[model samples]
Target: MSADDKYPEESGRRRFVKGVVGGATLAGLGVAGTVSVQSLTSASGIGGGPVEAMTIDRTGGPAPYGMPQVPIEIDDEGYIRGVWPEVDTEEVQGVEVEIAREELGGLQYSQEWFQYCGHQSYEGLDPNFDSDNYFKSDSAPGYDWQADVKDEGDRFHIDDFDDYEEWGNDVGNSGVGKPATATWRSEDTDNVIPVVIIRSSRMEEAAQESEWLDASTDEGVFAFVNKCTHFCCVPGYKRTGESARYNAEDRVYCQCHQSVYDPFNIVSTLYIALPRPQD
Candidate 1:
C-alpha cells in the first residue's frame, strides 16, 4: 500500500484515461440506439427497409421505366403462380406434343412445352376472353382489351384485342371482372420457367361459326375454357424448337416444381401434386 502503488504507474493512468474517453465517445453517439450495417441488409432487421425494399419502387402502380416487374403471376385466389401466353390456343388447334429426354455433361435434360407439358384452360368465361378492364398488356397494339370478349368471327384473333379495346369494352360493359390467372417462362432466358398454350375447343367449334351467333339477342356466349387446375399459375404450353411456334405437340408445364401434366387427360399424379382448388 505504498504511495507509488496507490497512485499506479503513469502508463496505467494513461490507459485508464483512454478507456474512459473511448466509452464517453461511444456513449455520446448513443451506441445503444445505433443500428448495425448487417441488420440493415436483412429484411426484418432494424433500420430502413431491406435490400429488396431499397431497390423496389413501390411509389406508383406500374414500376418506373426500365425496371422489370419481376415476373409474378397472381391468380384469382391471390396465389403466386406462373403462365405463358405466347400461343393463343384459339389461333392454334388439334396439336400433338412430343417429349424428348437427353443427357448432356452427365446432366439430364428434358424438353417440354405447351402441347406436351400440360395445360388448364379458364374456359366458361365468355367471348373475347382477352377483353377485360383489369387486363393490361404493354405489348399489344393500342391495348384493345375487354372484360368479356365479343366474338368477331374467324377473321379476328385474341391478339387483335388490345388494352384500348378492353378499356372501351369496360366502358361498354360496366362492373369489375376478374382477370384470368396465367403464368409462363420468359422467352428471354433458358432457365426461365416453362410455359405452353392449350388450343381452345372453340377452335374446333370453328366449324360451327353459325352457332356462335344467334338472331335471338345482341349478347351471345362464346365459351373459352382454360384447363389450368390451379388458378394463378401459367398453363404449360409452348414449343421448344424453331418449328414449334404454334406447335400442337406442346403440353402443360409447371415452372415452380417442374411438374408436367397431360393437357388432354385427367392427370392424378404429375411432377408434384399440389391441391387443385375446385371451381
Candidate 2:
C-alpha cells in the first residue's frame, strides 16, 4: 500500500499523543463532566474530554466500554509494529496544548482513547517519547505457547503465527486465534504498556468486509491495549478454563471481574479522556 493508504505524513497532523497509555485510573473521576470541571483549573495536564475510539466488542461485564484497538503493520521483514498517531498542537480552554489525532477507518483515532485510567500521565503517552514503535514480547505471558516461543523483549514477527488457524490450548476450542502478549511504546520507562496481538482466519475474513478492519489489521494480525476498562486489569484471549463458565471460551475474558469481549467484533465507544500530567 502507498503511504497515502496509511496514516498521514508527519509533516502535518492534527495529533498529539502517539504512544500506548499507561496503567491506573483516576480513582475519583468517573464522570466526564466532573473530569471536565477539574480540567479547567487543575493546572495539572493537557487534553481531557469525551472522545470516541474503536474497540473490541464488550459483551458482558461492568466495563463501560470495550478496550481500544491498536492499529498495526507488518514491516518488510515481517516484524509487527503498532501504528502511532501523529503529533500536533491545538488549544483547549484557551491553553495551547499538544495533541495526537488522525483520521482513520472513518473516524478520528487519537491518543485520547487511552487517556482514562491514569494513562494520560504515563511516560509512554508523551507525544515526544521516542521508540521504534514495535510491539515487544512481555517478560511473562499468560499463554504457555508464547512463553515457550518468545523471550522477553523480542519483537513479534508475522511468521511466528503460522498455525493460527488450528492453534488451541486447554481453555477453549481450537482455531479461534493465536495471541501474543506484548508491550508498546514502553521502552526504557517504569511504565509498561501491555498489549495483546492475535492472528486468526476470522480477522482476515472480517477485514475483507470492513474498511476499518482492512486498514488497521494485516495478515490477520490485530491488537489492543491489554488492560480491562472496568478495573485496569490484564485480560486474556481463550487463555483460561474459567472463561467457559462465563460463555467466553472463544473470546477475550478478564479474570478480574469476568468481563467478556468478542475479539471478532470492533465497535466505537465514548469516554472521558484524562489530560497528560504537565511537569
lDDT of 2 by residue, 1-279 (tens): 243221123313212211121122334344566678767766667877678889999987556689999999999999999988899988777778777788887778898888866677888888878989899988887688888888989998988899999999987889889998899999998888889999999999999999899999998999999888887888899888878877889999987666789988999887778778886
Predicted structure 1, TM vs. truth:
0.19
> Which candidate should be chosen as best, given lDDT against the real structure?
2
Best by TM-score: 2
The count of backbone overlaps in candidate 2 is 9
- The weakest ten consecutive residues by lDDT in model 1 span 53-62
CA deviation > 4 Å runs, candidate 2: 1-31, 40-42
Q: Per-residue lDDT tens digits of candidate 1, residues 192-235?
A: 22222122332233324432122101111111122232223332
Q: Cα lDDT of all candidates, in order?
A: 0.24, 0.82
The TM-scores of all predictions, comma-separated, are 0.19, 0.87
Query: How many clashes (backbone N, Cα, C below 3 Å) per candidate?
Result: 63, 9
* Predicted structure 2: lDDT: 0.82
Which TM-score value belongs to model 2? 0.87
Per-model RMSD to reference? 26.3, 11.9
